[model samples]
Target: MRKKKCTMSIPTIIECFQMGMTSNEIALQANVTARYINSVLQQHNVERQPHSSWLRRYTVNENYFKTWSASMAYVLGFFAADGCLPKDLQLVSFSQKDPKILEDIREELQSTHPIKTNPRTGVHLLNISSKIMKEDLMKLHGMSPKKSTILEFPYVPEEYLSHFVRGFFDGDGNINYKKRTVSFVGGSQTFMEHLKKRLERYSFEPFIVSKEKYHRLFLSGRKTVYHFGQWIYKDKNLYIERKHLEFNREKLPPDQIKDRPFKAHKSAIEARKLKLLYYYNLYRDFPEACKSANIGINTFYRWISTDEEFQLKFNSICNEKKI
Candidate 1:
């Protein structure tokens, strides 16, 4: 049988991706299935940007009040990082590959909304479509529907700011033990700058790096990384365990570190580069190689493009294999 043709043009899909439309939304607008939209997006290697909440539809929840609480702050922080309140859709959604994180979010919100998983991509999406909850988030948290570039710090109580930041960090932060860097990546310049100021208020030094379309706030050096980790995890049992464990590895005793399989930094980030090189040689096991090397697959590919030595070594290995 002849293969079915794609109805939507590649350019249109790219345009929608640039507009921060989710694959499903793009599919809906373009008269295609979500899977088809995703396939085309993958072909173009388009990065999936977060959705803006500007056009979200909702009924007012008169009972909602602007109260400060740890749970509310955490939910706001997590939403600021990875969630979306699509205007016309009348829904607030958070999607992550990890189901555990979604479960944590569900429990935090104390909501009955069902968690839906996309079988093809293994991404779990938590949807909140209730008008009451939508209005509550908007009024209490200063969450605007169109909050991408205009996002600012949420109205978190002073004492619970750390909890909120912790939730945001868990959603969008990255910790590189070898490099001793703690980074938060986002597209909102205002939000990032506010975060820098907030960290400064807490006596934590953070610097921001501007990329083409996004910004990254970096907290470097052992002192800052250690301090931030200790502060954020002080409450214990309220964080992403894997990240907290990795963050505190440096403070572990030698025996304890060994037992926990923690590798101390060798005064160099080159250690990670070398590991990446080793993984690059495992050509047949591409996904597992990237996982083992503790880097994203796209990042591994980018390294091959930018690093001459890495590219040369990979090419040489490929030549030797003659496959």
Candidate 2:
């Protein structure tokens, strides 16, 4: 009881974690710092996991994903270093004994590689697999599942599954995600139903944005977007690429073999599509909107000023007539 008074609140710590908040992320979100975040966690005896250091590290799962879900508390990996996908993506069961479906899965994997005919998995991975399937994705991803650290938000609603964020991340132009998640709303059953229904059917990738933005922007609270091609999901429920996990050349389960095989990142992936979607729909203007949204103008400028794509995205949204 006495400990609670001297240190930060437990909800505050946990909420940050659930939101896919890293030490740097938490500092920025909660108006603190990396050291301070560790200090607080220490006070509470909360341990720091690999995904704990945001904007600084990147890696992925070892075995198949275990109870992976696209939501809070789930950790994802980003491309910290410039590297090609693992060889497994390229190593299809070319042998005669290979199952046709598994061969096709391997063939599909081959094309997504950045290198020609050299199939590498990808820069990141997400543990969306739950129970058995998750195990598969993790095995494919090559890392441990990020533990449910802590998530705390006093006012975010539960129904809205997704949205967008403009200038709330880091300086390099990348941003973290905080969506409603597949599990939180209905867990794997509902998530699988929706995921299966939408595969290849839509043109846009369903992106995960800031939960706080949805509450203020869309009145109806319909959070989630259906996107395709260049735009992809990140943040809590996604993975970029990971480290320290092992991979054993194995075959995909017969059931999953026929399912839409997860493909690697597309060639020339850019922020253009995401920007268009954001500005045309979810983007709010500067200054007043920034203040109200709790986003600083400095942040807004930092992102747009340095990145050409970001500027183009913003300018196109605002209808710049050109100077």
Candidate 3:
């Protein structure tokens, strides 16, 4: 007697993700542990199929994109209103998802005229920046930020900006260049300020909002008058852009890039952790790729072990895709 094979389908997992269903939900309905579901889905290559059909068939809610803003992508809406970039907000597209924050940003765009909007989704999102100063903006750019809103910070500092750039604003070429040198090229102090004020709806951290101004006054040598970013003199054309950063070990946060702890299988997840450490250091380690995942490193490994599905899914991305 041949029993039926309960092979998990890619569309099913994607449907669950699209319907904004959590791992637990998917696990329950699929009659498989969420971890196993993630594992199978990861193995299935939906991308190998036509994207348009895949998306149309999947039909995810537009607002569902906001989940990318949360650490673990609050499937249960634990931090819906507060969906700014979490420590682990990596692994998802951040800049592309910036538009999702527009509904949350509407309060700040108080212009009498029709508020400007981006072409792709018609959502007017602020350009990401770290050097802009809040007070300097109101005085310089003629912007009128809403004083009453709880999301008061109008800027993201250099350190915080790095996280988004590397994690979210990613680019091609294996290594995430956008995140590595995450920075803006133009803007007045005021422009940066207004931009900051609007991004509060997203998960951008406020304390990590202003660094250029503080550095100018105390750390740097030049007399940089601008508050938010640097004052550049290119071809005698005086303008400003946010400064780029180095990839030195000291430059990165003391720990590995923080974000929500993703779950996966013990063996597969461990393999990934080892790979992550290897890649992170291999750039300079000049050593061969290590074999085992770092056990004590990220706590998320346990979650991955328990959830078979996530382990499967993360495996697709956990390896040396960039390398």
Predictions ranked by TM-score, top down?
A: 1, 3, 2
What order do candidates take by lDDT, descending?
1, 3, 2
Give lDDT tens digits, candidate 2, residues 1-323. 33433234556666455334566755665555677777777778765666543312322222222333332112211110111122212111111111232223223232221111212532222211123333343354332222111111211122212211110110011221222111111112322233323432432233322222121111110122212101233332222222101111114343342212112222112222242334333445455545444445665666577778767756765774343
Q: Which candidate is the best by lDDT?
A: 1
Name the regions of candidate 1 deviating beyond 4 angstroms. 1-66, 252-323
For model 3, the run of ten residues with the poorest summed lDDT: 215-224
Output the TM-score of candidate 2: 0.19
- For all candidates in order, the CA lDDT equals 0.68, 0.30, 0.31
- Scored by lDDT, model 2 comes in at 0.30
User: Each candidate's root-mean-square deviation in Å?
Assistant: 14.0, 21.9, 22.5
- Candidate that beats the other on TM-score, 1 or 2, i.e. the better one: 1
Clashes of each: 6, 39, 32
Task: Kindly give the stretch of ten consecutive residues in candidate 1 with the minimal lDDT sum.
Answer: 53-62
Residue 287 local lDDT, model 2: 52
Candidate 2 has its poorest 10 consecutive residues by lDDT at 163-172
Q: Which has the greatest TM-score?
A: 1
